[model samples]
Every structure is written in structure tokens, then in C-alpha cells.
Target chain A: MMVSLRTKSSFLKIYSWLPILALYISVLNEFDLNYLNLEYFSFNFPFILIFFFTLKDFKHFDYFLVFIAGLFNDTVVGLPLGISSLSYLLICIAAAYIRNITIRPNPVKDWFYFLFIISLINSLNYTVLTLFFSFDLILMSYLVNVFFTFTFYIIFVSIFKYYMRGLND
Target chain B: MASSRDDFIIAIRSAFLKKSTKQKFSLLTLLSISIFVIVLSSLDLKVIKYLKVGINEIVYRSSFIVSIPENLIKNAFIQTTEYTTFFNRYKRNIIELENLKSNYVSNEIIQFENKELKELINNYALSSDKILAKIIVDHDSPFLKSIIINKGSKDKIKIGTNIYDQSYLVGRVIEVNYKTSRVLLLSDLNSNVPVTIAPQNIQAIVTGSGSDYGQIKYIQSGLSDALVDDSIVYTSGTGAIFKSGVPIGKLQSFIGGSINEYKVEFYSDFTQLKYVFAEVITKTEIIKPEEKVAENNDETNNPLNVKLKILEDELKIIEETNRKFQEENEILKNEINDLNFKVSNLNNQISSQKKTINQFDIDNQELDFLKLNLKHGHKCRRTFLNTDGFIVGTLEYKSCVLSKGANDG
Candidate 1:
């Protein structure tokens, strides 16, 4: 209920500059920046990690935020509206609810949660799309997307949280 | 309480400050994530389309690729649906063909029966000499009203052959090919047949005047006796076009002019055509008048001819008288026919009048009898009592009672 002024200002700086950075990266993403093909996963993960780290106290509204993000994806990506929305909401709510219920959180626990949430979202998205849209959502393709995104997000978010701690000091 | 209130204000300000930064970062991060997903999804879709097209092309190029188990399975699914549709169409066609075949066979049998009946009837008409030709095809030309028969020069089908179906004369063969002959029907523009007024001996050239009903032109004068529905016009075999006595058609009803050159009606049903028979030329016999005269002179020189000459002179005289007599007889016969017809009609009228007179006489006699009874003092009596006393009372009846009795009687 009581958020500090310093935390609030840091959050503002992260959110305000975040879009310009994301947009620049998106333009960069158009280039096939295969740095050993790790960028493929790193591309979407960094942005999502930044968003995920913003979930501090009001974790209940995270799925709603993810749902809005999914809508934007639905329009821009031309995917079925409900498909990505369902997957994003599933991941956000699960992460947020677990964070709320758990008494303690560690890097290992965070990584596990992150991996599970991404994989669950990707696999469910694939399955739903394949069944309803009559597309062949091969398991290998879905796994590739999930693992890369998870690895990149975990690494990036860890590094990001560390830098934020310095800013806090 | 004041310190606590100040702390509460500080708390509210801090809350707003935290939300402001978080909201900006969250919105920015979410926007970036959404764009990232969209681009990735589009790339994936393009790759999928490319892969699919490549696979299809490989399968198309190599039959071996198409024959692969997976490809074969896919093809079988597609082909089975196609085969089911084609098989249903084939089955329907087979059923329709079978139905048509049955009807065709029955129609053929009926045709055979008709042909047999025709042959039987034709045998009666030309009992001694007759020909039968099957109708192979009939190209009924509305423009020409002509029919082409299958018979040709091979079947001795010649020009001037009397082409007749089993029923009536269709036409004579005009143009003959090796296998086919064209018949100029009596209804054709350029076709004409010399038809005679039957039983009346009045002849007319029934010319085809561009219609199914022919024009009976060149009818000799003084032939008004041609009655409607009277006789069937037959070919006179004069022009050697058609054989004599081929039943062409019957005289249908016609309007006659004062000049006796009336239109002869024909009953030739040209519409119903099937088979026709053509009578061929038998011999090339040519006898001129001069040869016949020389033959007569040679025949007169014999001894039997001397006696025959006397008989011939007498025959000549008799022939002369007979010629005059025939002329007179024709006039007299015509007069007699007219008189007889009039007499028959008058007899009918007289008989009818006699019947009426007899009825009137009977009525008059009854009336007179009623008057006599009334004069004898019969008065309004409903009934007469049979009394033993004679002439005790004369019963009378009213006119109404008498009328009722008359009706009852």
C-alpha cells in the first residue's frame, strides 16, 4: 500500500524510456541478427522481461495487462484474437498468483516459474491454433520458441534486476 | 493526529509517483512485446507457406515422391472423395442407359408389327405385283416438304418410280444416288402428279403449290360433279411418273368456282411417313402410231381378214352410231342422273308431307267426332254410368276432360 518515492521514480524512468528502446529493438529485429541464432529468442524475451519486472505489488492486474498486449499482437500479427490472448493471460496470471502465494522467492524458483509459464503458454497456443485453425503446429517449432524466449528472458531479467538494485542504492 | 495525517499525505504522493513510472514502463514493454510477437508470427507463416510450396513442387516433379506413404495417404483421401462422386454419376448414367435400351427394344417391336400390318394390306391392293422397301431415314424438310428414302439405283430404285408407303403415295424418286434417292413429294414446289377424279373420270393435274395441300389445277371444264369427301385421287400413270391406281389421297372438302375448275382435295397424310415402295420400269417398250398403222394394214390382207373386213365395215357403221349414241347417252345419262337425284329428294319431301297430311286428317276427324258428340247433347259429364236402360241419359264431357282423355289415350 505504501510505495517509496525512489521506487516510483525508477519505475517511471524504466517505463518511459522502455518504449523508445523497444521500438528501436523492433526495427533492429527486422535485421536477421542471428548472433549464433540466440537473438531469435532474445528478441521477444528482453521486452517481456522488462514488462514482467514491472509487476511489483499489483500482480492481480498483470493478466489484464497481458491480455491488452495479446490484443495488440492479435491485430499486428494477424493471429486469431482470442488465441494469443488466452495464452498470454494464462502465463501472466499463473506467474502473478504464484508470486502472491509463495512466501519466499529465489533465482532458481523465478527461473523455474519463467520457464514453466513460457513453455505452457507456447504449447497451449500451438495446440489451440492447430486444433481450431487447422494449422500444423509441430511440437518442435513450439518448443524451440519457448526455450529460446525463456532462456533469454531469465538472463536478461536477472541482469536487469541487478542493475536496478544499484539504482536503488 | 497531525503527524499521522502528514504521513498519510506522504503515502498518497508516493503511491502516485510509483504508479506513474510503472504504468509508463509497463505500457512501453507491452507494446514492444506485442510488436515482437507479431513480426515473429508473420515470419513463421511465410516460412510455412514457402515450405508447403516446395513440398508440393517436389511431389509434382517426382512421381516417386507422390508415391511415398504419407503422400499416398493424402492423395487417397482426396481421390476417394472424387471417385465417389464419379462412381455415382456413372451409376446414374448406366441406369438411364438401361431404361432407354428397354424402351428402344419395345419401340422396335411395335414398328415391326406396323410393318407387318402394312405388308398385309399392301398385298391386297397390289395382290399380284408389289414391292416392299424399308424406310431407313426421313429428313423431313419443312422448306421442301420432301423425304429421302434409303432405296436407290442398287435396289432398282429409278426415276418415275411410284414411291408409295403401305398406305398412300408419298412421291416419285427425283434424284438417285448410289445408295440413296431423293423423293419429290406431291407437296414439293416443283412436283406435280396427274390425279384423276375417281368414279367421275374427270382428271386434273394436282400441282404442288408450295404447300402440304396441293393445288388441283388444269381441271377440265364441266366437271362440277366433284363432290367433297367423294373419292380418293389416284395417279393416272399418264406422264409415266407414277403407276396407275396408286392411292395418293382422297378428295377433301373444297370450294368450287362457277367455271367448274374446282380445287380437288387430297387426303394424303404426308406428315406420317415411314416406309415407301417404288415400282420400277419393267420394259423399254416403245410403240409409235405409224408402226401400229402398218401392222393393221398387214393384218387386213388375209383371207379371214376379207371376211373380217366386211364385219369391220359393219363394225365401222356400228361404231359411228355408237359414237353418236355414246355422246347422246352421256347427255341423257347426266340428265337421268339429275332427274333421279331430284326425284329421290322430291320423294323424301312428299313422304314427309304425306305424313303431315295423315296427321292433320286424323286430327280433323277427331275434331269432327268431338263436335258431333257435343251437338248430340253431351254436357260437362265427368263419367258415364253403365245403366241397363238404353239411352237413359247421354253423358257429356267437357273439352278439358276430353283433352285429358286424349292425352291419356
Candidate 2:
């Protein structure tokens, strides 16, 4: 059965705000499965979620709520308070720019654009953390994170496309 | 070219200034806020610090609650892995337990002695009480290794408080709230511990590698050759941050190109942490006996004064021992005097008994002589029939009577 909000139940109401709710939970919980013993394995779920939903211009995905989620992410991850907020808002701005520039939405173009944006953002994150905060971060870890998040973007985007199709129905 | 530039400008302006009906804050406004928050957070203002703590308190508790399902899954995965190696782990644990048991008694003694020695070296002695804190959130993030514990200022958990997983150094509390705190695990890139490499006696800084282990950094030049594989690493208490002699990890040397690189495999596993002990230390100043005199010399921070104070302490101990020995000598002297008096009294009693026995022997001899005289009196009496008779009162008469009695018999 196709899932739509026309049924007008509490579950449907929650379904409408699922993307924002997911951003909150992801920031709060950091659903990364580190216990899988994958030493070099991590992906930024919020980055993917924020990029896709903002690029699509989903009505329930509020920018303020995204900012709040960024604050929560900073608190949970023990980064200097606003570093994650900055990184997250930067992601939003990048997605918004891409969304405005594109008339014909092509997955291939968006995918390449995402790679560039994330690279810039990750590099910015590294420089800010190291130079300003004096954080001793491994450059290689950042590189690996960028690689994994970039690779997993395609997979999550497909799933998100299905979700969007269901919600639109 | 002009049309393309205009289109680019329009897109950029739309992205920055445009807001949808559902969005409250424009992208530019939020970006500005993000930068503002970053700058404010970097400042050490009291308002920001408290604000950060408040945010941390709420966020940590929320994260803990939100993490329950994921934690359950994680625990299940861990338990599943544990079940796979149940017997092997059990066997290894048993062996480790046995080794630990044998070392435990000695370790306790050493710890007690260490407290005493520390007290001797410093005027204030630190007594630590380890409070158990449950780990509420441990995500093991790749970028930052940290955990949130369900203990904070309310539980006397302060910033810089050492966290331990069964006596092994796990981390230190970097942020403390009212009901929760954040511990920067030893595996975090930001963590730096001053450590002493044992058997080699080299001091080095062990910084987190953002991995499961630590990397040994800032060793004294030319001393890297002394470092061997499997050397014990422990906190040196330098800079007075971490408690001294706490076991941190073991050094593993990787030999490669021209210079050897070393890694520290921590004793406590950062991923497997569930509960940790937060050490709350209280320092009590030792009251010196000569403190009255030394009140004028209150420069306790000075090295020379400290040395002098240690010397005074040594002198006081020696003087106390001498006083004890003097008291014992006086008791012994009194005991000897009592023994000597008893010996003199016993000698007097022995002399009196000897005189009484001599008198009794004399009386018996006189009586025997009288009886012999009576018996022979008739034979020896100055009668004409006895030619050898003598006067009774004379000594010669007695002899003659005795001889006559013997002859008749």
C-alpha cells in the first residue's frame, strides 16, 4: 500500500515530520555502528539526510530545526560547541545553492556537486578544528570519513527517493 | 558571459536570502548565527560556560534516552560476539584473575606505602575516593572518542577527575554538568597523558591516535632506541594533572625505516566501557610538629624550604624513637633495682636459719654427754674398786668415766 498523509491520523502526522524527527534522532543518537569493529568505518548520516531533504525543499524539514540539530550534534560529539553547527549550516547553504542553480534535476550532476561540497566542508572542518581549536585530529580519518559519506550518499539517496515517492503518493 | 554571471548572481542571492513558507530562518541568517555561536563558544565567558553546561546536561540525558534502542542492539551484538568466544574468554579471564589475585595483596601494600611516601614528599596528602559512574552514552565516534557518564557536579565529579575502568586509566572528565559529565577517552586525539615507560625509565607524552591505541610522542632525543616492545606505560603525575603511577597502557614498538615508531595499547578498552570509577581527591595538609617555628617560613612552594621541612620531619621521627627507647630503659632499671632488694632480704633469712640449726646441734650433744655420765656413774665413781676414777665436775673425770663404761661393756 502506498503511504500518504490523507488518512489524517497521528501516525500520518508524524510521518509528515519524519525527516526533521530523523535529523533530531540522528544528531542525538549518532546511529553509527562502531561496534561492528570496522576500524576505518564511519559515515555522517546527518550530512546525507540534511543534503537530500534540503535539496528537495521538503516542507517539514525546517532550517531552524536543522540548526538546533547541529547544536545537539556538537554537544553529543564533544566538539567545540559551534563547530558542528557551522559545518551543518554550511551543508544546508551548499544544498540550497545547488537547488537554486539546477532547472533540470539530474542525479549525476547532483552527485558530483555533493562530492565537491562535502570535500570543501570537510576541509573547512579540519582547518577550523585544528588551527582555531588546537584539536589534534588525524587528517587521514577525515579523508576516510569523506570517502565513506560520499560513497554512502548514493545508497541513502535511493532510499530517500523511495520515501519521497511514498510521501508524495 | 554577462547573462551567465547574472544567472550565477541570482542563484547565489536566492540560496542565501530566500526562505520557504515552512522555514523560519534564512540560510544566510543561520550561517551568521553558526559563526556567532562558534566565536562565543571559543570565549571563556562565565555565561557561555554555564550555557554550554546546561546544553550539555539536557543533550546528554536526551542522548542517553534516545540511545537506548541502539545501545540494546550494540549490547546484543557485543553479547553475540562474547558468546562466540565465551569459553576462550572465560579461560583467559580465569588465568588473568589468578594473576590478578596474586598481585592484589602486594598491590594493596604498595598502594598504602605509596600513599605514605606521597605524604612524605608533599605537605598535603591526597586521599582519593573512586565513585562508580555509569556510562550513559558511548558512541565511539571516529572523529572524537568520548563518553557521557551519569555523574557530574552533583556526584562530586569535577573537570580533570580521572576516570578508571577497574583501576586502569580510561579518561578524564573534560566537561561537568549538574547530573552528567563528558569524559574525553584516552583514545581521543585531544588527550595527552604524561607517561613513564617502564624498564626503560623514559618519560614521554602519550597522545591518542584517534584509534584503539595511543601513540608515544615527544620522547627525549636518542632515548627511542631504549624503548623495547611490551614496555609498561604509567602516568608519571607530571604537571600534577593525572595521579602518579596509574597504569595507562603498554608500549609496542614498530621497527621500520631509519627511526622506530611506538604505539601504546591501552589497558582499558574504550569501546567496551559500561561503568567507570571517577576519582574524587581530597588533600589534607599535614600538621608538622615544627610548624610553629616554620610559620615564619611559609614559602612551602620553594624547593629549599621543602627540603628543609623534610629534614625537620626526619629529625622529629628520630627524636620520637629516642624518647621511646629512653622510657624503656627507665622501666628496665626499676625492675633491676626491685630484683636486687629481694636478693638481699633472702640472704638475711638464710643466715638466721643457719644460727638456729647450730644451737640445736649443741644442745643435743650436751644431753648425750649427760646421759653417758649417768650410766657409768656407778662404775666410775670414786669407789676404791675403780682405780682410774676422777672428780665428777672435772673434764678428766668425765673422760675416765666414759672409758670405764666402754671397758665394762
Candidate 3:
């Protein structure tokens, strides 16, 4: 099957804004398979999505909208306001920095870098929630979240890349 | 080294301040705003609170709408699993329902009596009304466990308002908005409840393990040994955070390496919760009896005066009863005297009749003697007949007449 896009049409317009839309939906829906009753079964879909799209510096992915999505996430997750926004913005900054320094990105290298970024973000989240906000958080959960997010990043990257290629065409 | 430092500075500055063509704000600006919001929200300002509530109301609704497909898939998956054990679950549910039905009436009675006692002890009556609330969002996130409910300030759901699943304590409200509230489930790590272990009567705190169960913590050191498996765990009402005697869970003992570890398996399944009840409590102070009297009347008669009045009324009743008894006694005495007089008159009449009977007996003897004398008149005449006879009117004449009559017979 051949795929093509009609320029300036509503479908194309919606297609261009898919990443930001995904970000909003991810924050709002929080698609964690928690009902599976699996112990330690969670991954940060927004983290992986944000890292991949922001690293590509996608034109339609708005930073302000990301910040707003973070706010929505905090509300839905019952976290202190702006906590997720800080974490999301921090991911954007890290992705931006990595983009600036690398002329050509290797998937393996970006994957490892994502592992590091998510670890740092999760640790930062744990610290801020526990110390600053007086939240009782399990360190193990954060570790598990980091591990799952890191493991899923590469799988999601392929899908995001396919979308990127479709947009380019 | 100086060139490398300059390159690093450029990259950092570009990352912080550079905005792409489609981006409205740089990363640094959003980050600063996030930090500002965090600080402001932490401080709990009125404006910030209202703003947060407004955001929560909208976001919770949006989340509910957005989570529809996911919730559908989740329910389908759960229902598929539930069908495998359908009969067993049904049988178990039937048995449980029977037991619960039996306990329900007694439990209600105990709860009502408990409320009365609590009111008496607290000097205020707490009339709690539980409002039904729909669970708008139940993420069951591992890090922070909470759910958004459809009851809030409009439904009188305040912070710390207890949430329940059919009388089972599930959680408490931590955040409230206009029509939405956030309940921190007992399975959350931050959720700590003061609880009592039954049969042992030991007190401890139950903190959520961020899983399906709660860990018993802050118990007295040696009291842990007394805890047995399947012991009841209920709220102790310490810290005034939860109502006393609200059942939380059952205590389960597990081996944690060398020592026994105790955990509370919550009575409510947080994952399956669709609707919950939020208790809205209103406490009205109890007016003392004296105060009630003073409010109702200004006669100034207190409890002592009331008691005295009751005693005086009792005395009057006793006196009236005694007077009636005396009047009855006087009437009885008059009747007895009249009866005695009638009895004496009857006795005199009896004696007169007895004397008249004796006179009649004498007249009958004289008549009998005159008849016998006429039959033997010549023999009965003492002077003409024989010298042995005496005067005719003497007793001897009568005897002689009777003897002559006997001799002639």
C-alpha cells in the first residue's frame, strides 16, 4: 500500500500535531496497566514519547503545550502542582542538549542516554516529592519506573520514527 | 580546555534559552514556571488553592472522558478472568452475602449504639451522612495511589472526610474541589492509619505498602509477639483522623527473613472500586438538662427542685391513700358495732323463748295430771281414800294419782 499526505489539509494538519496530541492524551489517560494487578508493572509513556520527539526537535511539538500537559498529568496523578511540569521540562532540556552536541545520533547511544535521563529524572522526582513536598514515596517504585521506561524507549522509538518518516513523505 | 568549556557553555545556554521556530517558550522559562508553581502550591495560598481546584475539576473530567477506551479494555480483561472462576466466586459471594446479612443487623445496632456513646463522650452529636460518589479516575499508580471522585465541596466532602466501600473504610479525602475530590487510598504509601489489633487489643499504625496490603508499623516492641494470624484490624481513632471501630482489614503474619512480619490485608479491593461513599459529618453540641430547662422556662427550678417536687407529689399521693384507708376503717367499725347490737338482741329473744318453752312444759304436765285424776278421782283423793294420801294440790297428790292410774292400768 502506498501512503501519501495531502498538503495543508485537515488530515495533514492533525497528522502534524500528533506528538503533542499524544502527549496530552498520555498525561490525561495515564495508560498504566495497573489493573493487571502485576506487582511493579509500570512505565512512563510520556517520558519515552517526550524524549524521542524532543530529541528529534519536531517542529509541531510545542514546549509550552508540554508544560501544560505536565500540569494536567500532575492533576490527574494527584501530585503537587508543577511537579510533573518540572520533570517534563527537564527531559526537554536534556533532549535539547543532547541534540545540540550530536551531529548524527546512533540509536544505541540515544537509548543509553535515555536510560540515564530517565534515571536522573526519576531520582529527581523521588527527591522532590519526598523531601520538599513531604510525600511518602517508595524508592523501589521509582527504580522500577525508570527501568521499565528505559526498556520501552527503544520499542517506542521505532514507532515514532515510522511516524516521522510518514510526516517527512 | 578553555575551548571545550566555551563549547559546553554554548550547548547549555542553547538548551536553556533557544526556542525552535514552532515553540512559543524556551525550556528554561517553562522550568522556572514549574518551579514557581510548585513553590506556590506548596505554600497553600487561597488563590493558588482555588486555581488548583479549578484545574483539578477540569482535568478530572477530561481524564474520565479520555480513560473510557482504556477502562473498557481493562473491564473486559477483568471480566474475562472473572468468568474462569465464575461459579466458585458466585458460591463464595453467596456464602459471604449470607454471613454479611446475618451480621448486618447486629453491626448496625452496634454502630448506632457506638454513635450514641461517642456523642455522649464527646459532648456533641455527630450526624454523619454519607453521599454516594462515582469514581471518576482510578489510576492505581504505583508511586502515589489516589482516585478522583465526583463529590466535593458541593457535596460537603471536605479534606479528611472518610471514604468507604459499603461500610468498609477505604480511604480519606485529601483534596476537594467544587465537584471533584481526591481520595488517598489506604493502599498508598503515604496513607497511615491508627489501628488496633483485635483479640490482642494491641495498637499500631498501618502504613500502605503501595501494593494490595498494608504494613503494621509503630507497634509497641514486645506486643508484636502476641499478634496472631487472621486477627482483626480496626481503626483506634487515635489522632482523630479516622472514626473509631471502623474495620480496616485483617492482620496476616508472614515470614520476613528470621522474624515474623505482620501486614493488614485491606477489606476493600481498591482496584475494583467504582463507587464510594463520602461521609459528611455535622457535630451539634449537646445542651445540658439545666441549660435546656433555662432555655425553655425561667422558673429557676433545677434538678434538685424537680426531684423535690416529685417527692412532694409522692408524699401527697401517700397521704391521700392513707386518708381513704382511715375513712374505710371508720365505716367498717360502725358496721361491726351495728352487727354486735343485733347479735345481742337475738340472744335475748332466744333466752325468752327458752323460758316460754319451760312454762309450756309445766302447763302440759298439769293438764296431763288433771286428765289422769278425772279417770281415777276417787282413788286420787288422799283424805277419803287412804291415810297415805296428802292434800289434793300437793306434789304427793299428783304422784298418788299417777300411781293409782298406773295400778289401774
Candidate 4:
């Protein structure tokens, strides 16, 4: 009986690390459904995962791991090595600032704030990639990506909340 | 107000500098590192390049392994769609195959002649071998169009090596690692192919529209008017970036608010590329026989041997020229014999035709006479009551009959 309880606890520990694991998988696999053939139909999954975990201050969501995931994202997407890392770190900082300011965080406010944060981060990303890296990115693509990432955040956050609830239980 | 201001500053500072127990670094530190890395990467350094290469090799392989399941799903979906349209595609392919087959012979002859002419002009020949590479990661990034292939410096794939999807230009390698390379697809916004628009022979640069098509740019103002829809766009080999005459896409005209736009629909779908060829070219200088001889012989050689060598070379040239002349003479002789045979055959035909014409003339005359004889022959015949006519078989009697029996009248 003791052995089974120990195994269950270990399993719970692994389960708690799922968000970061998903972030790594999403970056390496580039978890955008591009095969759907919808024009300008991509959303950054890592951004959503990073934003939620960092806001909640999940114990397993290491900043270094997120930074490394960003590097992997850049390599896979053929960007400069640290571009995604910078964007991801910025998202973390923004989430952290918001987390610190709010006493009783409202979900609706958080959702709208998430939109604003992604917009600013995406704009910064576009500026850095275009000005510094000399990349020729379409403004419309970045806009659409920001829109979709913001729109999908609430949906993903709800699911993440359920997982959080289960973890606490 | 002062306390509130302090709260805001405190929050901001905490967010930047605070590190939780489980986190190894603060967000500010990581952010600074990211910026430092970006600045370092932008500067050209050999150590940084090697480091980037090492990182790329590991990440590319890991990405490929991690992407396998997703790739399988994507492939399955694509296969399903292909099967749905298989019959129609097969029919279209059949028609295109037949047309291509008829053009294949002429194309081969043109390729051979082009090779010979290029060799004669360039003083060196480029022998290229294409190595097949499988795509390892094709994430189809929304911002950038690029793919990672499982070939790199180890396979002689260098930056700017032209990648092809069956002779159609796909893109060029932008980055190379030890065992992998990234190809910036021609559909990327940064990709600009110097191309010549066919049929009009207009030279222009095609920049990617950050989509599946490319846009024509940098053309002379009036040349845009000459670009019709479906005009072929091919690499002009201008600027020595790409090989000449490689087909890129076809032009598609779009009119938007009193302005005309031309887009190039690429021949090879960058999205569908599973494998591509990287052309590794090696140039060899042509060495003349004289140069070879000069290298082998010593300076101590007598003037006589040099004179003899020149004479031998001259003799060889003369003999070659003579041989070519003899072949030409043989061809001309054969042509002359053929013409003579034709002329003799025509003469025989003319004589036979003349004989036939004469026969026809004689028959017509005989018919005329017979018609006249119905009345005049009786009048001119040596009959019992026509003693004034001579015998019918006599020449004088024939003449009299020909006179329409005038003498008898």
C-alpha cells in the first residue's frame, strides 16, 4: 500500500511538470495547424503556455527552460537564435508584472490584458526581427497571429485552470 | 499618491529582479542574455558561426525526431486529398507526359549544343552532381518560409547552393551546419530571384509576396505593360546567383484600384516538397594539347624538336580540316547524284507526257475528220456517181475531204 502511494505521488509530481513539457513539445514540433491551408492562420502555442504558467507562478515552470524552448523555437523556425527567447522572456516579464499588481485577479481583465500584452510583444518582435535581423515579415501576418493568439488564450486558459484545480485537489 | 507611485515601482522592480525558489534566473537576466545573444549573433564571427552550427545540428535532429508523429499525420491528410483527386490528376499527367515526350528529343539536342557552345566560350566546364536530401523540419512558419534539410557542409552543401524539386528551383541554402542546413524558400519575403519573363523577354526581379506566389518588381516602367498572364518567369543567371533558364513560375495578373499587379505562381510547391536536390558543382579548366606538351618537355630541347612539334600540330590541324572538307564533299556529291537522278526521272516523265499529248491530239483530229466524213467523205469518195473525187485512200482525196467537200460543192 505504501509503495502504491509513493508511485502515485511521483506520478503527481510528473503531472505538475506537464505545462513546461508541453511548451518544449510545442516549440520543437511547431504546433501550428498550418496544413489547414487557411491563409494567415497561425498562433503561437508557446506564448499561451508561457503566459499562463508564469502568471500562476507554477513551481515547475522554470524561466531557463522557457528560454531554452525559445532557442529551439528559433532554430526550428529559422529565426535568429535568441529572437524567440527574447519574445518569450518579454511575455514572462509582462505576466509577472501583471501578477504582482493584481490583488484579486479577474479572469475577464486577465484575458483582455493578455491581448494587450501579446500585441505589444508581437509588435516588439516584428520591430526587432525587421529592423535588427533584416527579416522581411508581413505586417498582416503578425497582426493575424496576434489576433488568433489572443482569441485562443481564454479557451486554453480555461482548460489550464481545470488542470490547476485538479492539481490543487 | 506617493505611496501608490512607490507601489508601482516596487511591482515593476520585483517583476524584473525577483526570482522564485524553483527558478534559476530572474526574468531580467534572461532578457538581457537574449539581447546579448541576438547582438552577438548579428555580428559575423567565426566562433559564433561554429557555435551556431553545433547548436543547429543537435536541434535540427531533435526537431526531426519530435516532428515525426505530426509529420505522419500531415502526410496522411495530404495523401487522402491526393487520392480523392487521383484520377483527374492521372489524366492531366498523361497529357502532359505525351507533350513532354515529344519535346524530349529536341530538348536533348538543344542541351547538347548548348553544352558544346558554353564549353567553347567559357574555357572551363562545370560538372555538377545533385545530392538528394530529405526535409527534416518544414514548420511552415507564418513569418518566414524556410525548411531544414538533412544535408549540410558534410555533403558539400554550402550557403547559396541551389536546391531543386526535380529541376524546378525551390530555394537556396541560407545556413549550413555540420549535418543539416536551412533553405530559405523562394516564397519567403526576403527571396528575390532575378528572372527573365519569357515570350516578352522582359527582365525583372521576382520578390516573394510572403505567400505561395511571388511578385514582379524592379522592372522597367514600360515592360510591366508587356507582361501578360501566364508568361513564364525563369532565372536569368543575372548577378551570378542562380543558374540560367531554371523555370520559377508563371505570371498571373491582378488589377487593384487602377493599378495592375503581377504574381508568379511557382512551379514547385514549397509546401509539398519532401525531398530536394542540392547541386554540387565542380569546374575543370580545359588544358590544350600544346600546354600539356610544354609542361612535359625540358628547356634543353633542340629547336628542331620544337619546330617538328609545331609542324606536327599544323599537320594535324590541316588533316582535320581536310577530313571535314572531305566529309562535306561526300555529302555534296551525294546531293548532286540525287538531283541528277531526279532530273533524269523528270525527263523520262516529260517524254512520256509528250507522247500522250501527241496521241490525244491525233485522236482529236481523227474525231473531227470522222465528223466531217459523215458528210464530206461521201462527197469526196470515189463512188459510182462521184467520179470527180479521186480514190479515198489517196492523199489528194484526203485533202479534198478536209476542204469540207468544197471541191465537190
Highest-TM-score candidate: 4
Q: For model 1, how does the per-residue alpha-carbon lDDT over B349-404 read when each residue is reduced to its tens digit?
A: 99999999999999997786576456532333433553322242343334444554
Better of 1 and 2 by DockQ: 2
Which residue pairs show backbone clashes in model 2? none
Q: Report every candidate's CA lDDT.
A: 0.54, 0.86, 0.88, 0.88
lDDT string for model 2 (A39-79, tens) is 86888889999999989988888888888898999999988
Better of 2 and 3 by lDDT: 3
Could you tell me which residue pairs clash in candidate 4? none
**Which lDDT tens digits does candidate 4 get at residues B1-409?**
9999999999999999998788899989999999998988899999999989988998899989998999999999999999999999999999999999968755765676577657656768999999999999999889999999999999998899999999999999999998899999999999999999999999999998888999888999887888899999999999988999999999988886798888899999888889999998888997644456668876625567666765775676567556666876898899999999999999999999999999999999888767778878877788888888888778887787789745445
Q: Estimate each model's TM-score.
A: 0.28, 0.78, 0.78, 0.80
Task: Give me the runs in candidate 1 sitting further than 4 Å from their true place.
Answer: A1-169, B1-130, B225-228, B255-268, B284-409
Interface RMSD over true interface Cα atoms for each candidate: 28.3, 1.0, 0.8, 0.9
Pairwise DockQ winner, candidates 2 and 4: 4
* DockQ by candidate, in order: 0.01, 0.58, 0.60, 0.67
Summing lDDT over every window of 10 consecutive residues in candidate 2 chain A, give the lowest-scoring window.
A1-10
- Which stretches of model 3 miss by more than 4 angstroms? A1-8, B288-409
Extract clashing residue pairs from model 3: none
Per-residue error for B326 in candidate 4, Å, reads: 19
Proportion of true inter-chain contacts also present in candidate 1: 0.00
* Model 1 TM-score, all chains together: 0.28
Worst 10 residues of 4 chain B by lDDT: B298-307
